[model samples]
Target: MISLVSLLVAAALVCLQSGYQAYAQIEGKNDLRDNLQPNIIPMPKKRALRPFINIAGPPPESARLIPGTLLELSCEVIGFPAPTAQWLKNGEPLTEFDDVNEIMNIHPTSLARLTSKMIVSSAANGDVYTCVATSGVKQQMASTTVVTVAGNDEESLFGLEALFRKPSKPIITEYYNEVFQEIGTSILLPCKHFSTSPSQVYWFDGDEKPVFGNPRMRILPTGDLLIPSLHWDDMGNYSCTVKNAYGKDTVETFLYPNKKQFFLVTVN
Candidate 1:
């Protein structure tokens, strides 16, 4: 009976060992398959970007005018992504007023675009105006024609007519006299000294009052004063005075309205 029991125990032990081996083999096969296979995790993708933007247009030129005169401004621009348009006066945004008018425009295309216009009266003279444009994440800016207002109307008949027609103030050439000649004669005053600063050249009759301060007179490219169609009464004592933050200096010359006159120059 004891021998029978021993044989049964050995057989049972062998069966248990075989079952353990089979289970271990199955687990190893699963681990190997997991390492050899690619991971099933999902990854994110990248996106594209938009293009750059640009703008182009004509800006306003310098402006001069008589006080109380009306002013009008027009501006246009081109750009990409369509731009926002606005106007500024003296670096400040412009608003509608009794003496002012403004217009804005925009267009659609691969390249966006804009246009603006403004109008103001003479009281608005001597003031500066600017136009600006903006698009999606982009912007552009431009200045309008600088408008200069005219001075008082009280002036000599000879100079007054020039002021009304296109009167220009005489620029101070130096603290010295300027020789002027008859209407048809050519006169040259050395303006090299006056180019350093913008000064006022006052033409006065015997009373020592100013004859011209308006824009009727134009500054010639050569730095000489050009009075287009001279008259017998145009001659007088002309004084060029420079005024800056530092101080002031005056130069005077005797001129004959119809004859050519040249004066020696001295600057202080």
Candidate 2:
């Protein structure tokens, strides 16, 4: 009877061991199959970017005008994703101005441009207006075009018709005395001297008023004047004075507006 019990226990142990071996073999085959199988994740396709603005040619509405004489000052731009346009009156937002218009043109290829125009019936506010283009991607990614009205004493003339008189103070010059820019362009009036000592620089407009406080103009760290946008009245006399412990030296320059003056320069 004891031998019969012992034989039954041995037989049961052998059967359990065989079942576990078979299960292990099956699981190992499954893991091998999983590792050998190819997993392919599709990569996303890249989009073609729109052609950027060259800004090398004349803008859409490239005209010169005197103050309160323009029917309208047009600011135009080109971009993709159909950009939304806005305006500014003397560095202020479009909401303050009543006489303004916005026009948008869309292409079938998903590109677009905006033409923003404004009119000033009175000269009480200012002659400088701006056409600002808000980026389709971001508001900060933007640009501006200046629309200047003629000053009270200035004449309203087309870019070609407008004649710039020669500078009152002729050449004892170190730099270019004449800087002619388009109606809605920008230019830098450079002011520097070979002095090693620390010096102070001052800028003055044609009216003998200080240029430091103007909102439309900025003086860079290098004592250079940056006129980001140009208008009709922006044409005039500008002076840069540098003073040191030794003495003071001043240079005067004439900034003018023209239609194709710069184009001729690039061509030559």
Among these predictions, the greatest TM-score belongs to 2
lDDT of 1 by residue, 99-192 (tens): 1222212222223223345544333445676766665556666665555534443432334355345522322322113232346543332221
Least accurate 10 contiguous residues by lDDT in model 2:
165-174
Can you give the lDDT of residue 148 in candidate 2? 51
lDDT of each: 0.43, 0.48
Clashing pairs in 2: 66-150, 67-149, 67-150
Error of 2 at 169 (Å): 21
| TM-scores of all candidate predictions against the true structure | 0.31, 0.33
Model 2 stretches with alpha carbons more than 4 Å out: 1-174, 260-268
Could you give candidate 2's per-residue lDDT for residues 1-268 as a string of tens digits? 1222243357567656665666566667767788574433223233444434311111333334444332344444444333444555556775644223223232222233333344433333233555555444444222224445534433343322332221111111122243444667666565534333467888998777899899999987666677877778887878888876667778776665555431100100
